[model samples]
Target: MPAEPLATVVGLLRDKFDLALPETSTELWHGHPVWLDDDLPVAGFKAYPTFVTVLFWRGQAITDHSGKLNASGSAEMSEYKLKSVDDFDSDLFDVWLQQVRELEAA
Candidate 1:
């Protein structure tokens, strides 16, 4: 069953990032919800029996973003599981989103 928060978050993504979301069902990579972009892997979200995980692609692209991610509450999170909706931080996520946009443009 899809959680309300998941749909809400997906909406948040489409509204904010304009990422033409991949046809994501329950999938995993690095052991988490694999939200794909353009048939290639981009971002991911993990859904435990109880919660959802949000994983960002281009992690290497943000090598210097640890402080921002941590301060904003997106730090050192499970590279495998997300247990709360709060785990999805749009602020830090927006940066990765921008990277995706730039990559698409280029």
Candidate 2:
């Protein structure tokens, strides 16, 4: 993938995450930016060759009526893949973030 598009998507995601997850700590874990709630992985994003994947650690437990999140990895993990900026949905993302926070707290 080209750097420009990737950068734009990453910038948007980072800014949104920063604003929505103010109470969480963000760090580069395994070379990917991840938000942690007291050392527990809450959410994160990883850039792949064809797309960017936004992940919720306990997403399987989240109530996503939109059906955008796809089960990923093990445990309760889920992911939404974006091929470009156009694929990003702010409203859905916001809702997911809120659910992720609540799940983390629980």
- In Å, residue 83's CA in model 2 sits off its true spot by 0.2
Model 1 residue pairs with clashes: 33-45, 46-53
Give the per-residue lDDT digits (tens) of candidate 2, residues 9-106.
98999999999899999999889999999998899999987789998889898888999899998788999999989988889889988888777767
Report model 1's TM-score to 2 decimal places. 0.46
Model 2 misplacement above 4 A: none
Give the per-residue lDDT of model 1 (tens digit) for 1-106: 3477666655554454334442333355566455555555555554546654444555444444544322123543223233445656766566656665555445
State the local distance difference test value for candidate 2: 0.88
The CA lDDT at 33 in model 1 is 50
Evaluate model 1: give its lDDT.
Answer: 0.49
lDDT of each: 0.49, 0.88
For candidate 2, the per-residue lDDT at 57 reads: 89
